[model samples]
Target: MAKGSRADHSARLAAFSAGIRATRGGKSLDINATKLLVAITQADDADRLADELVAKGFRLTRLKTHGGFLRRENAAALIATTEDRLPAALAIIRQTCRARTVTWVPPFPDGIGGIGPAPMEIEVGGAVVFTIPIEGVELLGGDVAESLARTRAAGGAQ
Candidate 1:
C-alpha cells in the first residue's frame, strides 16, 4: 500500500470503530469473557454509580427502564468484563447502591368502593445483577483495539 493509502485506511478503520462504539453508548469493546446486566431500580443513584464504576475501570452501557411492580424509573447498566473482574463489579454496585425505605401511596382499586389511597413504606434503592457468558468479541480499530491489545500484552484474560 502507498503511504497516503495507509493513512486513508487508518482513518476509515477509525471511523468504523467509532460507529460501533457509538451504538454501544461510546463504550469500548473490552472483549471480556463475561457480561453483567445490572438492573438498578433507583434512577436517582444511576449517575453517581455510573461515574464510580467508570472510575474503577469498568465500562457500562446504561438503559432507562421502568419497574413492573412499582412502575417507577429504573436504570439498567450493562457491564462487560472478565470472569475474574465480576466480583469487583458486583462489589462496586453493592457499595454504591444502598437500600433505603420509601413511602408512597398505593393506587386505588378498581372494584372496591369507599376506599382511599393509603401510604405504604417499602424498601428500595438496590441493584439487581445478572451475569452472562460472552463467547467472543471483535474490535474494528482505534483506541478500543489498542486497549485490547494492551490488555492481551499484559497477560490479561481475553
Candidate 2:
C-alpha cells in the first residue's frame, strides 16, 4: 500500500510539472503579477510608476487593496496592464524599490504591547517577490518621462 501511495504521488507531481510547461507554451493570453512585501511609504506613492508608463502609452488600472502586511505596513497585490507592458511596469517597480529600505522588528516579550523589542537589524532592506499573471489593477500611470523631459530641458545648453 505504501509503495502504491508513493507511485500515486509521483504521478501527480509529474502531471503538475507537465501542466506548467504546457501552460507556458500554450496560447492563453494571461498577464498577472504577484509582488510580496512591497513597501510604499504612502499609498499614493504607488502611482510613482506613471511617468514611464505614460510615455509608452500604456494604461494602468489600479486594483483593490489585495492585502497588507500588518506587521510591517507592507503590501502585496496586482495592477493591470497590457501583457507587453508588464516588463516596463516591473522595471518601474524595481527602480522605485531601490530608494526604499526594510528592517525586521523582533517581537517584544509578553505585556510589552505593540512596541517591538530591540530590532534584529536597523536596515535589513526590502525586496519584492514578483510573480507573473496578476489578476488586475485599478489605477493607472507609471511613467516619469514628462518630469524627466522638464529636468533635461531646464539643464540644457551647458
Candidate 3:
C-alpha cells in the first residue's frame, strides 16, 4: 500500500477502535483505580522521568506548565494506574526528580529607591506529587489500553 493510504487506513482503524472502547453495552469502561498528578518544577528532569516511567510500563501524559516564585518551566505528568501499582509509579518519580540548589535573583521594584537585585542560592528541582483515588478511568483506542485490558483479564499482578 502507498504510505499515505496506509496512514489513512491506520487513522480510520484507530477511530473505529476508539468508538468501541468508549462504551461497552452502553456503559463506560473504567480501567484505572488511582490517579497521580506530579508537578515537576525542574524542566531538565521531565523527559528523563517520563522515559523512566514508560520503561517501567507506566503511561503518562505530560503537560507543559510554568509557575512558582521564579516562574520556572515545569512539566506536569498525569498518571493513571491501579491502586496496587501506585507505589511503583511514585518510586520512579522520586528517583528521577532529585532536589538541587539553584541561584535565583530577585527583581527589584521600579519605584524602589536604592535596593538592587540580589542573587541568592536556593534549593529547587523536586517533584510535587499528589495521589487521588479515581473512581473510574476510561482508556480508548491504544496499545496501552489493550495491554491493560489483557492484564486485567489474566488477573496479572499489578
Candidate 4:
C-alpha cells in the first residue's frame, strides 16, 4: 500500500474498531460527563459488588463505613462512571446487594428494670445508592513518606 493510503487505512481501522466496541456495550465512551454512584451496602455484599463492578470495567473505591440505623460496620462502594454505564452498574448492584430481614434487639434506657426491648424483625442487608452528577473531579495524591509517617503514628497510638 502507498504511504498516504496506508495512513488512511490505519485511521479507518481505528474508527471501525471503536465503533464496534461501542456497539458491543463496553465501558461508557463518553468521557466528558461523569457520574458518581455512592452505594452503601452490607459489608458482605460490598466486597462482591465492588469486585463485580471492577470486572465490568467500572472504576470504584471501597470504604469501610458505619451505618446510622444499626451503628454497625458497613461497606461503601464509591463508583465513578459515565452516564452510559450507569444503568448496567445499577443492575449489578441490585442483583448483588439483596435485602433481607434480621432480628434486632432495641436497647432500652437504664430505668427499664435491666431488661431490653423485645427483638423485632427488621429489614436489613440491602444497599442504598445515591447518584450524583459530577461537574468535575480532582485527585490529590499523598506523599509516600507522609503516608508512612501517618501509618506509623496510627500504629503507635493503637
Candidate 5:
C-alpha cells in the first residue's frame, strides 16, 4: 500500500510540474516570435480573409466593424502567429484584400442654399494590418480567441 501511494504522489507531482511549465509559456515560447495581427477589412473581404487564414493554419477571431469614412460594414480580424509565419500571413492578406475607388458625398452640417455637397471619388476596400508583440496570453473559460496568447505561450496552436 505504501509503495502504491508513493507512486501516485510522484505521478501527481509530475503533472503539477508540467502544468507549471505550460503556464510559464512553455519552454519553446518566445516573446518576440509571438504577435497579434489586427486586420481591418471591408465587408466583402473579411469573410474570405478569415477563411483563408484558417485554411493556412492560423487561428483568428473576427469582429463586425464599421468604417468611419464610408460608414459601411467591415470586419476586424484578430490573428495570432509566430514571427516566422508573419510574412506569409501578410502576403495572403495583400493578395486577398484589394482597394477600389468609391464615390461618396460629404454630409454638410452647415450647408448653403444653392450648394449642398459635392460627390467625390474616394478609395476603399482594403485592409489595414497592425502587428503587436505579445507578452503573455491566456484563454478565459475557453478559446473564444482570447486564448491566442495563452495557447501560443503553451507551444500550442491558437
Candidate 6:
C-alpha cells in the first residue's frame, strides 16, 4: 500500500470534524433535602444535568464518576436539598425517567419524594434514576445491623 502523505491525513481529519458537527445538537425545580445524589448511566449527560440542576438553584456537591465495589462505573451527581422540595424533585425524576437510558438513586428516606429535593426540568432524554440511601459513612459489621435490631426490639416485640 502506498503511504499517503499530509494530504491524506488532512482529508481524514476534515471528514471526522464534519461527522461530529452533523450529530451534535442540544439544549429542575423544587426540592429542599439535605443531600441527594443522581446516578446516571451516561457520564456526558449526567454532567450536563448537574450543570442544569445547579443553575436552577440546587447546590451540587459531587459530580464525578465512581467505579468500585460492585459499581458499574456509572456517573453520579450529588445535590444538596431541603426537606419539602424532595418529593417534588422525585416526581420530576420519575417523569424524566420515561425517556433516558439510565438508572437513578432516590432520596435517602426512600420512597417517592423521600427527602431529596425535586429537579427543575426533566431532560428530554433522561431516565428514572434510582436512589440509594447513603448515610454518608461506611459502617462496620454489627454497627448498623445491631442498632436496627435494638430499635426493632424496643418496638415491643411486634
CA displacement after TM-score superposition, residue 133 of candidate 4 (Å): 1.1
TM-score between model 2 and native: 0.37
Encode model 5's per-residue lDDT on 78-143: one tens digit a residue: 887777889989998999999999888988776556676889999898788999986664433532
Residue 142, candidate 4: Cα error in Å is 6.5
lDDT of 6 by residue, 1-158 (tens): 13364433333223212101111111001111343556453444565565556555555554456554324444655643545556655554444334443344433564656457543433334443545443333224433333333433444121
| Residue pairs in clash, model 5 | 137-150
Best by TM-score: 3
Instruction: Return whichever of 4 and 6 wins on lDDT.
Output: 4
TM-score for every candidate vs. truth?
A: 0.65, 0.37, 0.68, 0.66, 0.66, 0.34
Model 4 stretches astray by more than 4 angstroms: 1-33, 142-158
Question: How far off is residue 5 in model 5, in Å?
Answer: 35
Q: Model 5's lDDT to the true fold?
A: 0.68
**Relative to the true structure, how large is the alpha-carbon lDDT of every model?**
0.66, 0.39, 0.66, 0.66, 0.68, 0.42
Measured with C-alpha atoms, the lDDT of residue 78 in candidate 3 is: 84
lDDT of 1: 0.66
User: Which portions of model 5 show Cα errors greater than 4 Å?
Assistant: 1-33, 110-112, 142-158
Kindly list the per-residue Cα lDDT of model 4 for residues 55-120, writing each as its tens digit. 886767899998678887899898866678789999999999998888898878876685678999
lDDT of 1 by residue, 121-158 (tens): 98888888888765545544555555443444555443
TM-score of 6: 0.34
Candidate 2 lDDT: 0.39
Better of 1 and 4 by TM-score: 4
RMSD of each: 9.0, 20.7, 7.1, 15.5, 10.3, 25.6
Clashes of 2: 25
lDDT leader? 5
lDDT tens readout by residue for model 2, 26-114: 22211232321222332334455544444654434433343334343343334434445566666766665443334656556886677
- Model 6 clash count equals 27
Candidate 1: segments with Cα more than 4 A from true spot: 1-30, 110-113, 138-158
